[model samples]
Target: MIVAQAKPIEEILEMIDKYDKILLVGCKGCVAVCAAGGEKEVQFLASAIRTARKTQGREIEIREVTLERQCDPEYVEQIRGFAGDYQAILSIACGVGVQFMAEHYREIPALPGLNTSFMGGALEQGVWSERCQGCGNCVLHLTGGICPITRCSKSLLNGPCGGSSNGKCEVDPEVDCGWQLIIERLKALGEFESRFMEIVPIKDWSTSRDGGPRKIVREDMRQ
Candidate 1:
């Protein structure tokens, strides 16, 4: 899932300080699962903003709403009816969601409340680590299911760099060497001799960001 972290309250306050009334939008999507932007978080932020403004001798009104997803146009349209009532919109969703809101409501300012972190999964409760770079290439078959592109500090394709030592990356002793993990995994699967011996070709990056923003269309899903 896409992981994100909330921006500092001070920065958020500065973004909306000029507006007396604003729409606080939350997404019940990836951000919600990560506890950064969700229904409960929206309420908490609203209260905090109000309290902060009150102490400054200023009054502000905020309307809180949580959308099933801010990335989908269908869900974004749901707010069109009353979005005009606000001076601006504050979205606590991922960067994509903020952009979608901004595109949909061109009349009002759409501001981001969270910093889009990366695409990753929860390692444990309250701990999430990045696992993929969405390189548009899958090399797990050649690496025993361990991703060399993301797990490796250097994004090495063939093998570990000279900096690896004691199964750990020299870049950070706490981080395990990506290739080391792959070698161990292949050995466990009894395919180390077969898989590890085969060399991976130079990666084709055209499928990734090298070509700029990407999009996909399925003829089967089109109207």
Candidate 2:
């Protein structure tokens, strides 16, 4: 899932300080699962903003709303009728959602309330680790399901980099070496010798952000 962290209250206050009326929009999608932006978080933020403004002897109006997904046009359109009433929208969604909101509501100021982190998953309680770089080319079939692109500090395709020792990464003693994990996984699967002998080719990053922003037009999915 897309991981994100909420921006500081001070930063958020500065962004919407000029507006007397603001809309606090939250997403019940990725941000919700990560405890960054959700219905509960929106309410918390709204109350905090109200309190802060009150303490300054300035009155402000804020409307809190949580959408099924701020990234989807259908859900975003649900706020169309009342959105114009606010001077600005504070979107507590991922960067994609904030951008989508800005695009859909060109006249209104769409501000991001969270810092989009990365594509990752929860490793344990309250701990999330990045596992994919979305490099456009997938090599997990040969790498024993470990993503060297993200797991490896240097994003090496085929390497232990002569720095790894005792299965730990040289860059960080606590982190495991990506190549070491891949080799161990392959060995357990009885394909170590065969796969290791086959050299991995240089990655063509054109499929990734190297070229430009990407889009997929699926004829089957689109009506």
Candidate 3:
């Protein structure tokens, strides 16, 4: 899922300091699962903002709302009726949601309340680690279910560069060599010879962000 972290309260306050009334919009999607932006988080932020403003003898109004998703047009449209009621919208969704809201409501200021981190999964309790880069290709089969592109420091197609030592990456001793994990797993499965011996061709980045923007459409769905 897309991981994100909340921006500092001071930064958020600065974004909407000029506005007397603001809308704190949260997303119950990826950000919610990550505990960054959700219904509970929205309430917390609204209270914090109000307290901060009250200390300065300035009265401010903040209305909190959580949407099922901010990226989808259907869910985004749900806020259309009352969006203009606020001076600015503080979106606690991912960067994509903030941009989507900005475009959808061109006249209203869409302020980001979180820093979009990366595409990753929870490693353990309260710990999240980066796992995928979404390179628009899948090579897990050949690498014993390990991704060289995302795991390897250099993203080497065929690697464990000369810098690898003791099964550790040269970039960081704490980091395990991506190829070492792949080789060990493949060796245990007795497929090292078959898989490791096969040469992997250079990846075609055109399928990724090399092209300006990508879209997928299904004619069957349209029908």
Best by lDDT: 1
Show the lowest summed lDDT stretch of 10 residues, model 3: 206-215
Tens-place lDDT digits, model 2, residues 6-79:
99999999999899999999999989998899999999999999999999999899999999999899999999
Report clashes for each candidate as comma-separated counts.
0, 0, 0
Give lDDT tens digits, candidate 1, residues 1-223: 9999999999999999899999999999999999999999999999999999999999999999999999999999999999999999999999999999999999999999999999999999999989889988788887889899999998988788999899999999989999999999999999899987678788899888897999989999999
Lowest-lDDT window of 10 residues in candidate 2?
A: 151-160
Candidate 3, residues 77-146: lDDT per residue as tens digits? 9999999999998999999899989989999999999999989999887788778888887889889988
> Could you arrange the candidates by TM-score from highest to lowest?
1, 2, 3
Task: Name the regions of candidate 3 deviating beyond 4 angstroms.
Answer: none
What TM-score would every model get versus the actual structure? 0.97, 0.95, 0.93
Count residue pairs with overlapping backbones in model 1.
0
Q: Which candidate, 1 or 2, has the higher lDDT?
A: 1
